[model samples]
Target: MKIDIIKKYNDVRTATIDFCSHLQIEDFSIQVVQFASPAKWHLAHTTWFFETFILKNYVKDYKEFDADFNFLFNSYYNSFGDRILQTNRGNMSRPSIDNVFAYRRYVDAKMQDFLERITDEEVIDLVILGLNHEQQHQELLITDVKYMLGHNPIFPEYHKDFNLIKDQNTITNTVKIQSGIYQIGHQADGFCYDNELGVHKVYVDDFEVNNHLVTNGDYLEFMESGAYSDFNLWLDEGWSWVNKNDIKAPMYWHQVDGEWHNYTLAGLQKVDNDAILSHINFFEANAFAAWKGMRLPTEFEWEIASKELNWGERWEWTNSAYLPYPNFETANGAVGEYNGKFMSNKMVLRGASVATSKNHSRATYRNFFNPTERWQFTGIRLAK
Candidate 1:
């Protein structure tokens, strides 16, 4: 079992590297948008994670893959020592794209060797968890790359035929959930991040959630009806955010000749009215829910409803902060630093986005980001 788990880890890690090879050298450094990272940095960072955690700790007499990598790729973990400055990640041109790929190969080789010799299940589980963590980054790689490329005036395509046609709207379904007690958070049976566990109970009032995400057409109606201009429809904070940011529409959306177009990795494309509205932050999502005379569901309601729905193409923003559960305990050592520190000042998002890894998402999975963050593939599901 240990051998097989390690092999799976190696396979997934190798695939991550392969995904990077799809991008051009020029694509690796284009961090034109503040919210997105350069693709090259992501490649190096994931490799740095394995080297710092498993190789440096578990491997016998393991040597550093690159001495400078400790400074170059460490992200936000003050416990690991002073990290590379966040904003300057785009400025790193010394290693070059080729050298970053080389760094990945070196880490991969060492990780495979360590995996083969390590027989402990605890070690195997950590490695598996690390691999999945890397896979989450893999999805972020695509989303970040998409955001970067979409910012270019020339508008490059990541792939020649990667366009997905908008699906036809079928039945407009609504699920009227009777308010009752429901269990929220993860139940540990398989691999899960620390923030997800704790079999806690919560009371939910009777609410009606839209069977699907609010679509582009639905949002357009709100815009046409002056949703952004009406201060009464928005919360004080949300209206302030809209005024401060001059948020007239969702990010990446532009109006040309009274028609809406969106910037995509494949260049500028017409907004698909049938598709769900994405790239809106929680503030915008909440305001829209208010405009519709509905309310955003709490995280508990989201988890309960999601357990029975098919979550695809959208991640629902819930009215909950990313906080530690009751009787919460952090895992010992560096991995403990993973989820606990960011528990404050972040909102929870349920379901997985279109860019999410198939194996990495589950109903119990909890994704969080600051309410102002809109660069992610974020959207909203309406609830009452």
Candidate 2:
């Protein structure tokens, strides 16, 4: 059992390192948008997480790769110490691409050595948690890199062949869930984050949720119909955002010769109407849903429906704040800082995005972001 667990943990860590190997040195430092991170920073930050949380806490005689890394890569953990200012992460070009890879190797060697010698279940659990956390960042790596590269005049492809999903017709089967006492949030789990725990019951009124996500074609219709101009179709806050930002179309979308084309990391391609509509925030999603006489699902409704469905197509925005469960308590020490601090003032996202790892996603995995933020892989699932 010990060998199997350690091997599994090491495999995940190695895969993360290997994923970084695909990018060029130049690609590692470009933060074209403020919302995205440079790929090099992501590489260092994930390593910093393991070193700070698992290695420093548990590994006897463990030495940090760089003393300054604790300050440079620490992200939002006030308990861990002051984090590098988020906006300044792009300015960190000193840790050259080569150094970042070296940092990863140092962390990797220590992690593997610890895995080989350690047999404590508590330690194993922490390793598994770290591996999972890295996987989450791995997905972010793809999205962040894409966001950065897509902003360049010469849009570069992240992968040579842009064929993760094939061109097959998606089933438009809308599933109607009966209104009743439906339990939402995390239930059975080998491992779940703190926010997903305390599986609580939530009563959902009878609602219809689309089997698949909204398509670009559906979104385009809203655009062509002047949906953005109609204040009635938008929430008060959403209308304010639209008017303030003059958002006429989804981000990355541009009209050419009266036709819509979207700029992707793969360059400007004709909008794939069948592909799930992505890069829209909660406000836009809610506005689009309202335009169609549907509504965004509440977090409970989303969880209840998502628990029974395939969720990797897109991360569905929920009409719920990322608050604690009825009787939630923080974990001891710094780990407690994980989910509690960001609970208020953020909207919850359910399911996982297309770029997300299949293993990393769960029905209860609650992703949160500000409502106006659209840099992440966000989309909408219609509920009525």
lDDT by residue for model 1 over 139-201, one digit each (tens)?
A: 788778777876776777777655422433354687778878888778757888888877788
Can you give the TM-score per candidate against the true fold? 0.95, 0.94
Name model 1 segments beyond 4 Å from true: 164-171
True-structure lDDT of candidate 2? 0.80
Relative to the true structure, candidate 2 reaches a TM of 0.94
lDDT accuracy of residue 213 in candidate 1: 78
Residue-by-residue lDDT tens digits, candidate 2, 41-124:
888988998899889988888888899998888888888877778888888888898898899888888877877888788778
**Candidate 1 C-alpha error for residue 207, in Å:** 2.0
- What C-alpha lDDT do the candidate models reach, one value each? 0.80, 0.80
Per-candidate Cα RMSD to the true structure, in Å, reads 1.8, 1.9
